[model samples]
Target: MILVVLGTHELPFDRLLKKIDKQILLGNINEEVLVQAGHTKYYSKNMQIFDFTTYEHMADLYRKANFIITHGGTGSITMGMKMGKKVIAVPRLIKYGEHNDDHQLEIVKQFQETGHILYWSEPMSLSEVLRLVKSFNPVKFESGNKKIISLIKQFIDGA
Candidate 1:
């Protein structure tokens, strides 16, 4: 199963959905696709689309997914990364009204540069990126909270 996540942003990320739908129509994607469509109101017979879902439900979907294709939201991208899942992130560009700014571009680029995820951007088709997923191995994600807590504990002990 392939999980597509569009975070809880008000803007419609129909652009990404359309691309995926095209792939399905072309038979490039033969697996089941589950989508967390958020505010993007799109109907696709090829996919199971949900307007919104609880955190627990989403987590379950993430676990069941073979890999994830997600918008360039930090939370969504990191969730897939932290789960050790291969992530293909597509940034929501301002020119398309998918986002208010191009910040998502930076976020996706950083993750891609760090070897945490692959990204779909201009001049690269999603199908091209999808073809790479079979061989992509994401770097494991380690939360910084543990290190922060350790530092605080050491400070208290010293004091």
Candidate 2:
């Protein structure tokens, strides 16, 4: 029961979808092209393809999912981390024509440095990464003046 999110970005799925068992793909799609690109009839059977109409609905799905595999979106990453869910964030690159730039990669690096999220560069190892999620122990940030200042600095510096 993996929540395989494609985010708002209508990125390619051919490689990523191949690694999951039971997936729920949430995002844009071209149903006709998906099949032609070898998305397989598996989506029609074992998986769900949804276009989230609102942010609340999307949040609901995020809360309900077992594991979160997403593109490197800070909002999604933060949501998953706050929920203490298994998150494997793969960055989207402009060279891949999947995003405006390589900002996601940098975000992924920063998230990894904080030890709050897991990242997978290649889709082929998603199973191994998912397995590792079960034993992962995330650092729970203790809130205080120090934490507040750190968070503020993060926003100011990153921005």
Candidate 3:
């Protein structure tokens, strides 16, 4: 089971949902899908759509996924990385009207280059990424956020 999260950023990314099997669209597109002009229906043959959910639901879904396909949101990616789950970070490009900037592209690039994650843009590469995900190993991370704790201490001490 793969979890595909399209963040709640007022973007229509339902197009990508059709490509995967047994996926859940993590956003508020329930009756408002593809027919924002006042129509009410969104039935994709491949995926199930969730209008909205709580953080616990999100965490539960994340824990159960064999792989993850999500936007380049820091929270989502960080969660996936911390769990060492196979992930495909697709940036919401401005051309696609998914984002206001291309920062996601650069962010995903840096994460990929650092061997922390994998990213896909093209449909063909997405297929390949799907195949490759099963074999990708997530790096081991510390149990506690020591670096952030240290940073906060530095700020408190005015260091």
Candidate 4:
């Protein structure tokens, strides 16, 4: 199963949903699709979508998913990454009115650069990215909190 996550941002992210719907229509995606649609109001026969669900239910869905297609919010991306799931992140562009700003691009690019996730963007179709997923190996997720704590402890001891 593929899980699509659009986090609880106020803006509608119909753009991403439309692309996924198209891919499903094209038969590029042959698996069951479940979506946490958030504010995006879209109807698709190819997917099982809900506006929201309990945290535990969401986590269960995440665990059952073979891979994840997500909006470029930090929480959504990191959750999949932290679980060792393959993540394909699409940034919501302000020009499309999907977000108030293009800040999502920054985090998406950072994660992509670090080899934690694949990203879908212009000049590359979702099908193209999906083809690459067969061989994509994501780097294991590691939290930065431990390093930050160590640095703070060192500073205090040195003082």
Candidate 5:
């Protein structure tokens, strides 16, 4: 199963949904597709979609999924990576009115550079990326917040 997760951004990420729906229509995606659409309103006969779901239910989906396609939200991507799932992150862009800024792109790029996930930047072909996903291996995501945590610990100790 393929899990598609569009995070709770205020605007809709209909573009990514449309592309996935189209790919399913063309038989490029043969696996069962599940989506957490969040605020995006997308209708697809090929996908089992929910506008919103409980965190526990979402966790079940994440566990059952073979791979994950998600927005560039760090939490979602990090969760998938930590689960050892191949994650493809598509950034919500301001030009598409999906976000107020392109900050998600920066996060996606950094994760991509670290080999923790795949990034679908603008002008990149979703089809090609989907093809690549068939054999993609994501590196394990190690927590980088230790430095911040250590500083906090030192501050508390000195206090």
Candidate 6:
């Protein structure tokens, strides 16, 4: 099963959803698709979708997912990576009215550069990504949040 997550952002990421839907319609995706649509209003016969989901439900889906398709949210990407799942990160771009800026693109790029995830920035065929996944070996994500924790400690100590 392929799990598609749009996160809980206010802006709707119908762009990514549409692409996935298209691929499913074209018979490129034969597996079952589960979507956490968030604010995106999309209807697809090829996918099982929910407007929102509980944390427990989300965690269950994560565990069951073979590969994850997600918006470029650090939390979602990190969670999927930490689970050792193959992740495809698609940034929510400003021009598409999916975000206020292209910051998601940068996040996607950084993750890709570090071998943390695969990123698809522009409109393209997901078939290529699907094929790549068979041979793709994603690097395990190592949390680098200790620096922030140290900064917080310094501030608390008035250092």
- Candidate 5 residues 25-65, lDDT tens each? 88889999999999998888889988888888888889899
lDDT of 1 by residue, 1-159 (tens): 999999999999999999999999988899999999999999999999998989999999999999999999999999899899999999999999999999999999999999999999877988889899989999899899999999999999999
lDDT per residue for candidate 4 within 66-156, as digits (tens), equals 9999999999999889999999999989999889989999999999999999999776788999998878999999999999999999999
- Model 2: per-residue Cα lDDT over 59-107, one tens digit each: 7766777667777888778777878777778887777676788899899
Each prediction's Cα lDDT score?
Answer: 0.94, 0.64, 0.66, 0.92, 0.90, 0.89
Once superposed on the true structure, which residue ranges of model 4 sit more than 4 Å away at CA? none
Which candidate, 5 or 6, has the higher TM-score?
5
Pick out the ten consecutive residues of candidate 1 with the lowest summed lDDT: 121-130
Ranking by TM-score: 4, 1, 5, 6, 3, 2
Supply candidate 3's per-residue lDDT for 121. Answer: 79
Of 1 and 3, the candidate ranking higher by lDDT: 1
Q: Once superposed on the true structure, which residue ranges of model 1 sit more than 4 Å away at CA? A: 156-159
lDDT of 2 at 34: 17
Give stretches of model 2 more than 4 Å off: 10-14, 21-44, 141-159
Of the two candidates 3 and 5, the one with more favorable lDDT, higher being better, is 5
Tens digit per residue, CA lDDT, model 6, 33-84:
9999999999888899998878888988999999999999988998899999
Q: What would the TM-scores of all predictions be?
A: 0.94, 0.67, 0.76, 0.97, 0.91, 0.89
For model 2, state the Cα shift of residue 36 in Å: 20
In terms of lDDT, which candidate is strongest? 1
Q: In model 4, which residue pairs have backbone atoms overlapping below 3 Å?
A: none
- Residue pairs with colliding backbones in model 3 are none
Which scores higher on TM-score, 1 or 4? 4
Give the residue spans of candidate 6 off by over 4 A. Answer: 145-159
